[model samples]
Target chain A: ADLQQGRAKANACAVCHGQNGLASHPEAPNLAGQPIIYVTQQLKNYKTGRRTNEIMSVIAKPLSEQDIDDLALWYSSMQVEVKMAN
Target chain B: ADLQQGRAKANACAVCHGQNGLASHPEAPNLAGQPIIYVTQQLKNYKTGRRTNEIMSVIAKPLSEQDIDDLALWYSSMQVEVKMAN
Candidate 1:
């Protein structure tokens, strides 16, 4: 997983997913800090038709195994802190 | 899945999970608009120790089957809209 390459390739995802990985939109999921394997599996699911989303299908179509790993690593490495509400 | 009952019981979750179900905390997964069964299963997982989280374990401990269903319904009913990043 090459984070440098992942960061470079992630511009396309910035719009819906937010540059910080916290999605500004309600519909697009916030992907920051997900497990590496979870993010990787999800992208693969989109590519394999296991998960169906018009936008995701197109975005995931061309990624190679390495591409997915790099992207997953980049997203999962984002720092996310939780502040519990009382 | 009783929305009314679920809504009434959800005050405890609103702080971290957000009243809208898009978690305010990045560490908390969004629960709004998730499938009812998925939410139900997750709560059950917490109760059964299949998944472990400090706060969630305490929260899920006393819930009955009906309580879980009601809470799951409440969170899943939250409306979430997505805007694609371009």
Candidate 2:
């Protein structure tokens, strides 16, 4: 699949993590540039309930492993926009 | 007294977190736009040994509460540059 597919699958994440994956909430972290391995692990955490965020768990539950890989790779490949001012 | 003072005090943070607060490492979260309260709390955590990163501890220990506040405000006020691909 392409990044488009990954982006589509990632739609559920846009609410908390902006459309481009920049985090909108103070507690939620921006997933931009996150290591693919770390991203996959966090998805696993959400899937397995090891990391407990109600919305994250709900979102992660439906994803197959392939979907997770695709999304992780897509997100990792995209550039994060400037979120904070220096 | 200004962002300049905060920036000077924040020089030590530049090694891991880039000069603009964008994290270079996969594991390190970019401190850009992080809530000032959270940033202060994390600094406090580092100082007190509640959060354990060797560098973070070294950097946090000597900071007085005012220093921490200044740094926190400075970092929070600054914009985080794009570090990852979108």
Predicted structure with the largest DockQ when compared to the true one: 2
As for model 2, its CA RMSD to the true structure in angstroms is 4.6
- The runs of at least 3 residues in candidate 2 whose Cα sits more than 4 Å from the true structure, single-residue gaps closed, are A35-68, A81-86, B35-68, B80-86
Q: How large is the C-alpha RMSD of every model relative to the true structure?
A: 8.5, 4.6
Q: Candidate 1: RMSD over Cα atoms?
A: 8.5
The digit string of per-residue lDDT tens for model 1 on A55-82 reads 8899999999988988888877775544
Each model's lDDT comes to 0.73, 0.70
lDDT, candidate 2, B1-86, per-residue tens:
35667778888787777676767766556666556766787788789876566577788888898889878887778654344343
**lDDT score for residue B49 of model 1:** 78
In candidate 2, position A48 carries an lDDT of 87
Q: Alpha carbon lDDT of residue B40, candidate 1?
A: 85
DockQ of all models, two decimals each: 0.09, 0.31
